[model samples]
Target: MNKIFETPLYPYTHHPDEDAETPVRHKTIVVGAGPVGLAVAIDLAQQGVPVVVLDENDKVSFGSRAICFSKRTLEIADRLGIGQKLVDRGVVWNLGKVFKGDEKVYEFNLLPEQGHKRPAFINLQQYYFEDDLVARVRELQEQGAPIELRGGCKVTEIDDCGDYVALEIETPDDTYDIEAEWLIACDGAGSPIRSMMGLDFVGRVFEDNFLIADVIMHADFPTERWFWFDPPFNPGQSALLHKQPDGVWRIDLQLGWDIDKAEEKKPENVIPRLKQMLGEDAKFELEWVSIYTFQCRRMEKFRHGRVLFAGDAAHQVSPFGARGANSGIQDAENLAWKLALVLEDKAPDSLLDSYSDERVHGADENILNSTRSTDFITPKSQISRTFRDAALALAGKAEFARPLVNSGRLSVPCAYDGSTLNGPDTDALPARTRVGAPAVDTPLGQGWLLDRLGGRFQLLTVDADAPDRLDVGGIEVERVAVSAAGNETLRERYLGDAASGVYLLRPDQHVAARWTSFDETAVRAAVAKATGRDK
Candidate 1:
């Protein structure tokens, strides 16, 4: 058994030899070697389930696709055990300035309070982010995780039988058939897997095409997000300048509705526009530039039989709010654990249905937010444009507009309010309710147990001495010492002085439920619901 399992990818096959026959079956076959696919593989492998990952690209791609990593994504990375490395390498961005013409309408400080260990957002290139994740997956693979990476392999077809999926994979060497208990498609927007499944990607594509360029700059710009509405270089068009690590900057120019695609790709044309935006004194060299159209869409279904869709394969949102890749990574995190559970038989196959239900809700909400953001910035009609201009004009006035301007609507965390799997709220005290808002902080850790608390499910009880009052079932419970001053301060930050007691945390770190005191029956129920043990 030890020799058979010595190679991380060996256990799923009959033997380790090159000519050895492929296994008749696998627990999971994840298509796409992108961040989402790798995340799913890592999650399942950690749980001792066999997973095989396939990618058409032989190597990781360069260029920054998504630049903003939200706090929620950071929390997810932390759960995967690579959060600190990401933080150390990425640039922490908490301040952003929104400009309308020459005037700065609103400046936001993303971190509203001190003592929080993590920032509200971080700016890192998507390529670097994937690099960290791939490294971690490789580490896990070395540690006996059953994760196989088949580079140059692409899924051509998927047959989703009730019990298993037969994947037709094409490789440089030859085409072959791979059978798995389940298939997860993380392929991008042009996903053949989605097409094969006959899922409709319903949404409209924006008419305006945008030019994106990553340039190395000699001039010093404030390490902040800068957005220009109706800039001189491209009147009635939006321009964005964001700082990247190593003096690199990402610049985007709205090319309007009528630009020729062939002309825009030329360095001569792109460089002049970039020079006009940054000024001649800036002295910058263009790294990479491309013209692409943005769209807002979501799949009709996230799952079809034994196959599931994740990341861009599941949804595509506009780039205005930086939600596209971030939301996809979140989907990966959400589905990974559920897939792991189903494969382990710790939860019934019905648990798989919740993946589509919960993630579709998230994806739809993301699409709505992105669409609204796109409308606000790129106003489709004259009336809409006028309204946006007036709003920006109003925002220029500090007294009349600060509150409205500083809503941080784009940065709001998603709430799983209408989830079918979420249990009923049974807490008597309003302070004890964990829904809508995150778990309040206690001095023992940091703000929002949802953010600071780590590793597995934790049932936190305020009654430190009432261990007998706790129910030890299929979950783990810890009676934190909230009596100390430091712990008290932490508690006060999240829960306030009026709130105290026990909280149940789900494996994903969201607060499942909370009570003013230890209630074994309620605790067990919450645990059961969270673990999908409930009927």
Candidate 2:
């Protein structure tokens, strides 16, 4: 037998005291070495910002913590330089089936509508996930990417004094002090920095608890998401099953706040539960086990002066939808470019405020969805459970009741509707690629539209040349021209029935503005608004 999740642990290194003559001040300091922290550090380093990352642990997460990687997260990983590795090393699945007792309720697919580059989702363990990110960051480090990953380093104190944020970090042997113009808190749900500032998260905590087990065995499980409410094997409780890479199956059993937490986690207690579901003949090895309660909460604002929060530090949702890690990755993507532009003096500092506004809006959406899923799965009151049971009963036979049945909504990219940074969208345009939406991935002649856009401010032109007369406060913008001869999706998304179209895209591949014709004035105005120069 082979261990599919193999990764080398990082080494613990010492941090020297700051030289009195010339202290090495970093532009950005990121806390934690998890996927979200590594991602934000990588994004900042790619944009030529020197970053220092601190982590108490010396390796990737040990277990299959977050197994679901949504499409938006993979796309962001693609831009950060590790999309293919994540795709190639994970189990891909799109179809999901939901059931009640012994009867099948319904099934669904996430990527039913085609025309995108990435799949709907992939199942991967968190250990391999962060390991791959660390490898990529090391590869870039060799090429002059100033990303300093200090494993076994813990942040003891954070001193925020408006102009700059100072950190007192301790290593295994010694302690040192450092300073950065900006600090990104990716330290996770129990954020130390967030605590130091007396910041509180306001949200609901469900009474139900869940037992998650990663079992390694050769079984007849299909490569799909199977969820059951009041299943035959585990009567009166819910269960979820998914196939991950390397023959490891993730099983989550909803034990509604009544079982002994310590006893259920024991192999003696867990194996019998498995026998009821898989029968006595099914041989399996228990790889890992954990018990957790659900809580959906987030900081009111992501930014506090020079310090900003990303990933789990900023918000936290229940594991039902897999929104925890995926949304955290998007937070890094959303803040990195804005921070880089502001640091380089290309944009006003107020541009970072938009990062807070937009991502706060995104966190709210994730929390809302996660709360609804948690409520549906583990209803609090008798009336709520009655409504849930009725919906599940109707879902097995009635087509109209399918929407009411919620196992888990899964995760999706957030469309930032009503964002202040959003510019004009021509009337009667396709709503899919409208302002405040993620730029639709269109298939070009031989590549994808996102590949051509790169990581800069790109002006996507359909049936029009790059605007030569456009100038937005000396901001550098790249123009990519698309033709209708081979690229129909681009025109359909941006131009609609119009003859030509021009779209200004943010550095993060989000649609800023679009118009029926190529107007240099409109493009520049959008740039001004996006960069916070106009507003």
User: What are the per-model numbers of colliding residue pairs?
Assistant: 7, 0
Badly placed stretches (over 4 Å) of model 2 are 1-8, 16-23, 468-471
Q: What ranges in model 1 sit over 4 Å off? A: 1-23, 399-409, 424-433, 436-455, 463-489, 497-499
**Local distance difference test scores for all models:** 0.71, 0.86
Instruction: Provide the TM-score for each candidate, comma-separated.
Output: 0.89, 0.96
lDDT of 1: 0.71
Task: For candidate 1, report its TM-score.
Answer: 0.89
lDDT of 2 by residue, 1-535 (tens): 2343444356675555433344456889999889999999999899999998888887777679999999989899899999999999999989999988978888989999777888899999988889889998898889998888888778888889788888877777767778889999999889998999889798887888899999998988788999999999988889999998888999999887877999989999999998889888888998889999999998999999999998889988999888999999989989998999898898888988898999999999998888899989988889998999999888878889988988888998888888888899877577888888888787886788776654678888778776643456777887887786666777677777778877888888888998867777778889888888885
lDDT of 1 by residue, 285-367 (tens): 77667887879898887878888899999899877677877788778766776777666566777777878887788888887
